[model samples]
Target: MAISKLRCLGLVVMVTAQMVSAETLSPAQAPVAALDAAEPTVAAIAPQVDAEQWVRQTTSNLSSVRYINQLAALYLANGYAPLWQDSLATTALEEQLQLLALSGVSADFSRRYAQLAHLKQSNDWRQYDLLATDTLLAYMSYLEGLPEYGRGWLFGAGIDPSLPLPSSQGLNHLNSAIETGQLHAFIAALKPQDRRYTQLQRAIDALAQHSQASWPGFYQPGYIRLGTRLQQPEALITRLEQLGDLTPYQAAQLRTSNVRIYNIDLANAMKRFQERHGLKVDGVIGPQTRYWLMMPVQERIRILALNAQRLRLWPADFPSMLVVNIPAYDMSLWLDNKHVLDSKVIVGRPSRPTPLMSSTVASVVFNPYWNVPNSIMRKDILPKARYDRGYLYRNGFRVIRSWDSSEQIPIHTIDWRLVNAKAFPYRLRQQPGEKNALGRFKFNIPNNNAIYLHDTPAKSLFNKTTRAFSSGCIRVEHADDLARILLTDSGVSPQRVDELKARTNTRTVGLSNQVKVHLIYQTAWVDEDGQVNFRNDVYSYDQINPMSQKEEKFTFLFSGENPY
Candidate 1:
């Protein structure tokens, strides 16, 4: 039901257009001999191999019949592709079965294989087929290096390589799974204990450009170009491997492309690759482009693996959501799963990193009040306030002294700086309007840290990609647009959102429905086209030695718990 919320939002799907099901270590139970006992598969195409004998000999345990049969159905449905059917004579499917036998190397594969074996035996043939198809679809979605959401496959629709594949109307199911919420359930149903449980999804998410076996860096012409670069396929793979992003399938795909360099197929493939990776679909490979292609796959994988862990930090459920991506310096507002608005943002500088956090928009302080942070007060404002007592008033700040023991009399007011030197008690709040630090439309999310995204009087910061200028809080470029979107359901119209912009008088607007806000940081992320994008690890996380981005170990503050 929680997942159903996403489906209500529009979804995009594309089946290879769907994805590749690669086998690995097998299941715990031995291979099923009963499948061989059942009707034998028709004599094999190409090199003839006994399907029944292979099943019986390969699968020793009858309990694994379910998984073995599931594999068979997947092979049969896909026309018995050699990869899925275990065509390699020497290393048969049984290898995976044995690994599942207990300790050893291919534990992830073996477990998946065993699960397949169980499904075949336990469920009806139709049910078995459906389950296998779903699993295979998910696996293929992973293999084609599709994101858990399949953005690549969707973008590939207009791309030349994917042009060969079938196209459909409406949302590309594969690409928009996450946006639509379908992936949440599929991901949740998976056995969390499995090693590949997180890895597969991480790989898919990382399948974007940064993880792809291509050039590295942004493809800006003068700065770093990919044109005129004579890159070897293996070299690209090697580089991606170093980056922790090269998957066996991606490596293989690149190698195959290398065999016929500069050809139309390769050109189209490159174009599709470029398109899926968030590059211009120009069929040329330049230096910056090449650099992106060469980013170590492992690095991209690590980023995605880390990001998946971050997604877990989101509220288990929220009526409405406003999530900010620190790495991209971007923020998105969503009602249900539908996107309301997205904008560029400026977060904190690296030394004063914006702390990852979450809270509800308890109140919307329109026009707003600005309580100067202590550091700014001491370093910037205090000096000015000391030089000129009227400085605070000039900047729209009002100094207030509260009555404590005696209700009638006001506490004695001293020169602001001298009062501070003598440890006087007073809170200075800036009046709402143009000069207010909070600008207009401050969505107040109650938390220990007084942090919230708001508008800024200075608009130039939005143009920079690396906008880490704030002191821990976030500043949005289109604050009013975001505010209107957040309050739309409460009967606040776009007209009102626009009107409030011109009418700058200070006023607070209470929200009928409190919105949820999440401040997140992911160094590597995927775009709508499934292109994997990476930000300069502003925190220098990539440079830190001995730091592993294991999804289970990396903790983030989600709701009230640490959902690592």
Candidate 2:
């Protein structure tokens, strides 16, 4: 389903810089209840009250409350006493809240927090017991929401983005933490567990260190080829140095040398920069690389932050899945959180970009017939057939008058030139063979979109670093091996897949369970080595800056998919 989640991500940040007005009016659905009258929570109360009865009455709407059960359990297990009343605990929570003033993730939580703050300040201390109980539990939601701020998650997949809520079994564990007086430690452990997330955090730190540095202006139309000489290359050297792409020794040599020629060393430095920025790692300072180089340091920092917030929304650990990253032109198969299959992929070109979605790998097709899309029939095949009459038959294609009937239509019976995409009534089918567009395998994922992952006959394209060559489907370099691995995983013996591949006819093998796949468009990610990687926004999703207030013209485009 389409959502404005990533779009909403830009509005706030992982850590919001929005100034908190402690004077805000009480807002949001209240938490379990308030903490001590001094701390923010759902309500204000005093001592000499029925803590258990008050908690039950105030937090009766446990399902509706963010973390009502967790809060209530903490109070209930502790004989209906306040949990976060410790000075150190309160101080720690305040710092976390202040750091996360970032309402970009969940504006709902922010409003709830403000309302709790309001209740804490109010002189009406009638519900002191309720306040003491909810203050800590409700604040727990805030801590859980920090790394995932601005990520409109459902809390299950896509992070289910629906977090903070606990199941019935978790209440026992919550009570144990309270019984052991480890609630503060328990709360402290409520951050993202992914190392990639922490890497993105480090990336932000690295960029922020130079946030105040004087950034060099973009050298427009800048193409400083190798061996090109310049009198003053100080700015160029400094910019590379500031980003840690260029080593100090190399940069210093370039800065102090009389002949500041773009040499191999400088080109190597540029390549490093290009690699990190998702550009071609050629030593040449080309237009694309120059454009990224020209971007203000602050803008890059924001971009990193935006990605970090997005990463936090992903499941902390998804044991099995296929993630096809569009921008990076790559696909990775993770099994038990380890890379089982890493293959280069060709995604849809800019004009027919692949839709960002999550689906499942339902089946495998060996020697699959290519059902040329109507769009391809109109735009690609028809025009060529009009001129080269032998194009269809010579290429092992058949013309079917109807999908159900499958009666072959004589190619020479009609005036090919007279037919256009709008008027074409026949379906084009390419016979499975050595020259078939889909080579040896097709990984099908059921979606409204016709997009799927499969093998391609055009093997040369996979060698390139930037491989956005497909019309819509993803073209994998190692489809045969991928199919075999998936088949084995699905309990379909390798011998069976091999047997199907040996035949001239098409075959389909359904998996025991559909492999979950998320075709995402992320431009920034942390690698296994803790290095942050960036890629070009091929889809232009980032054209509308995350921080910008403008919301127009950011419509979801999935024309490639058919409406179900």
Per-residue alpha-carbon lDDT of model 1 for 399-500, expressed as tens digits?
554322212222225555565633535545677877777777677777765677788887887866468887777888898777777667667778876777
What ranges in model 1 sit over 4 Å off? 1-294, 315-319, 383-394, 402-427, 493-505, 540-564
- For model 1 the local lDDT of residue 267 reads 52
What TM-scores do the predictions have? 0.49, 0.69
Each model's lDDT comes to 0.49, 0.64
